[model samples]
Target: MCVAADWRRLYWWVVLQWVVGVATSGPCAQRCDCSPKLPLVDCSSQQLSAVPEGVPDATQVLNLTYNHLKTLSSRQFFSLRQLRELDLSANMLTVIEVEAFVGLQNLITLRLSRNRLKIIPVGAFSGLPNVQFLDISENEILVLLDDMFGEMPSLQKLEASENDLVFISNRAFSGLPNLLELRLERCNLTTVPSEAFSRLTGLQHLRFCRLGLTALPNNSFRQLQRLQDLHVSRCPWLHTLAVNSLIGLNLTSLTLSHCNLSAVPYAPLHHLVYLRYLDLSYNPITTVLSGLLGDLLRLQELHLVSTGLLHVESGAFRNLAFFRLLNVSDNRLVTLEESAFHAVGSLEVLRLDGNPLACDCRLLWVMRRRLRLRFAGHAPSCVSPVQVQGRMFQDFAESEVARTFTCRQARILTRKPQDVRSDEGHTVLFFCAADGDPAPSIIWLNPKRSVLTASGRIRVLPNGTLEVRYAQVQDSGYYLCIASNAAGNDSISVSLRVRGFPASSRNRSGSFFLDGWSFASGQTAVNGSQPFPFDVKTLVIAVTMGFLSFLSSVALCFIFMFFWSQSKGQIKHTATIQFVPRSSASTTAGRSTVETGRFTMKLI
Candidate 1:
């Protein structure tokens, strides 16, 4: 008897609820065109060219997306006055006429994304006083008029990204005090007026990326009091963020990647105590000021990749106690000094690769000793002469990528031995030296066309020295010496010669001898015992070597010329042949002309 009574009571309650629903939905049913059996209406992805008037009466949800609609007239939606959510996304709409939603007084959510709408007239949505969520993203909106969104008194979320917006006027969003999220990414905006966004006091999330913004004005974001996440990345020309621009943001995540920023002031970001994730990757920043990034006490992840940094000064990261992951790869760093990573005790994953690290004795000491470190393996192995080439640290190291690493060598200049004085015929010496890895070998070229070695007349020093017993005037030609090592090779040539003697006999003896010994004016013949002081042996050797060099140069030049002529099919050759008066030239009195079949030769 108790179970039967309970069942009867439940049945009566259901009937009473149904009666209430019918009484309250009478007005909605009379305005809409949908069936009374269903409360929601759906016309999404139906290739609709215009607003559908076939909706059921008492409809609450209307979807007509993925269509080819070019316009939305206010009269078309005047019948759907009971709709609560309307979706018209993924259409080819380019315009919204005046008072487009004049009769949608009960509309709460509106979506019009992925359209080609270029403009939205003022007061277009003034009729929808109950609208809260509006998305017009992926449109061609070039400008936002002053009062384009002033009628959306109840709007909370607005997305207007992937557009051609160049400038956002002041008071464009002045009436949107309830807006929580606003995205205008990739809008091609070059300047942000100081008051452009001052009215959005309650906004929470903002994103602006891939726009060529260079700098921000001070106090640019002072009005946004509840902002939480701000992402501005992949802007190559951006450099500075003005002081206190993010004063009232109270943000949780900040990203500024590929911005070409070299330095940042620490005081500007001090107010962001709630920041958790910060990314400054793919920039050209070289130095981090003391206590710069350390001010972010709540930071959990920091990315500093490809920043061209060379040194990390101690205490640079002293205040990052809350950081969990740090990436410092693709930089020009050679070594990490002790205590460089001191305050990163809370770090769990560390990345340090793509850096040309010199693994010499100094770095070896660092590898063997430093304590309290928490890394996976040997800092991913310094890719010295071996490059990492777009691969990760672990991947490059796992393939035994260290075998190609080697040291670089220095370059040296070489010269040939020459006579210092023509009268005395004193022998001159030449040498070439360079500091290198694997030590370079020096080859000396002598006037005798032979490789020189260390022995009396010709000597070679460990420091790469070449000496000649007696230099002569004939030893005046090009001499080349090469020094090679692991890194590369270099060669130099010096023209060797003797000093010219004076033309007069008075410049050869007595007072001339004394002056000759003191100065170079008369310093050729000391005793006048040897005529010319010519070393025949040295001269013969030098002449022979010079002749050989000349012949070789001529042969090489001819070979190059032949190949070049064949490649281009052009021969530039012209000769002028002169003829003297012949003894028996009485036979030809006229213009003397000698010609062959296809050759014309004239004598003048």
Candidate 2:
């Protein structure tokens, strides 16, 4: 009997709620369309000047976009308790009064983009507690004050792009604790506000575009530990990035495109072990050195478009094991070599059409994988070796590859360096020049078979000239110069004889010797005995061997003295022997007939 009474009361309660909703909902406003089922109001794209009156009390979605509303007075939409979305974009909104969005407790999406609003009062969005996505882009806002958002605790994404933002208060986003993404692109940021961004701990994607800074200081985004993607584009003045700028973050995607960087910021990106997508397009970087990108072991997709890259050195991508896509289009590259990569077996997409490729043996790796690479948009073509010029890489037959894509070994252009004689204090020079299909790099090796770099007394010039400042006796030796390219290498050896006094053994590495032999003449004869060039490694080894010899001699002398003293009766010596009786194997030794003696001896 009690269960039947409860069912009857529930049915009557539903009828009472329906009666109240019908009695309270008013008729639709003039010049607007309204739906009674979902309760949506469309007052958008019209010449309505103010908020439409007589709107139904049960409306949930309101559209006021593309209108001529100039101001929003207080309590404009206070009665729309069920409102969830509000769009006022593409309007001429100049001012919004306080509590303009009051009583919008369930509002979630708000769009006020492309407006003429110069300032937004504090309480303009006071009652929007559940708004998650807010877009106020393309406005004339100059600054963001503290508490401007008015505590939208459920907000996650906020995009304020294309604003003339001149200043941003440190606490401007303090009320948005759950913000997952924030965009302030196309603003005039003098410097990255690292202190202000520390408050956004939950931010996953951060975009602070168009900075007037030359360099990002160390640990610039270290506080954004949860950040996954960071983009800084259209920053022409951002040329330098500190090695530790992206030190502590675990970003997966990074875009530093459309900047004025002269080279890749490899050091700053070396620690981004989790980075998979990288875009570094439209920079002025020229060449990438061999093995410099070895640290990016997990990179999958890479973009180096329009970077004015001329050469990709050998073994440059040797460490990228699972590489997929590479877009180096619109560069000045001559050709790419097969030796530059260790393995790109999983590569799916490639974009290398805009480069002036020679299509020679250096680029045979691309030809073999042309069908599998799936060239994006356009395929690579030959720009040199007139026989195959203007031909696509995919069109060449496998049998003609060797005949067409040929390599020209590097050949020395200038004559070998002459043997020069210098005095005790002088300088020496050796020059080497070469020519090849692709350019060759120069390297110098000393008499000790070690590669020469800029050191205390020796220097390597950019134009392949070896300069030795102080011509000491130890600097006299034969030097070898090697010019290498992708095809082959050529080398030549030269001799240097420095005449000096035996006692003039001072190292003046800090000061240069100005009085040197003229490099513009033939070899000169020296009148002194040639002394061996004192190589640093050779000297250390010789000294170590001599010390070992001295130690062995001292130890032998001690041993001899100890034996001689004993032979001359100056020291006492004792020797004792004893014999013991052996027992039977059965261990039945019940009695022993002879006394036993035992003796022990050691050979040294």
Q: Estimate each model's TM-score.
A: 0.55, 0.74
Per residue, candidate 2 scores C-alpha lDDT tens digits across 1-604 of 2223433654564366455553336788887787654457889887888878887877766798888989999988888897777889999999989888889898878889999987787767888888888899999998887888856888888989888887888878878788889999988777777877887888899887876667788978888999999998889988899989988899899999889999888899989888899999998989888887788888888899999999888898888887888889989988877677767687888888889888777887777777788888698888987888899888899899878887778877778557999875567888888888677888888777778875546767888888877576767889888998778999888889987744334333222322332443453222221222344455568999999999999999999987887688644344467765565223336853665666766533
lDDT of 1 by residue, 50-113 (tens): 7765565456677777877899876568877887778889999988988888888877788998
What shift in Å separates residue 178 of candidate 1 from its native position after superposition? 1.5
What's the number of clashes in each of the models? 8, 5
Clashing residue pairs, backbone N/CA/C < 3 A, model 2: 315-340, 578-597, 578-598, 579-597, 579-598
Pull out the clashing pairs in model 1: 32-57, 33-55, 33-56, 33-57, 34-55, 34-56, 34-57, 35-56
The true-versus-predicted C-alpha distance at residue 517 of model 1, in Å, is 44
lDDT on C-alpha atoms for all candidate structures: 0.67, 0.80
Q: Name the candidate that leads on lDDT.
A: 2
- State model 2's lDDT: 0.80
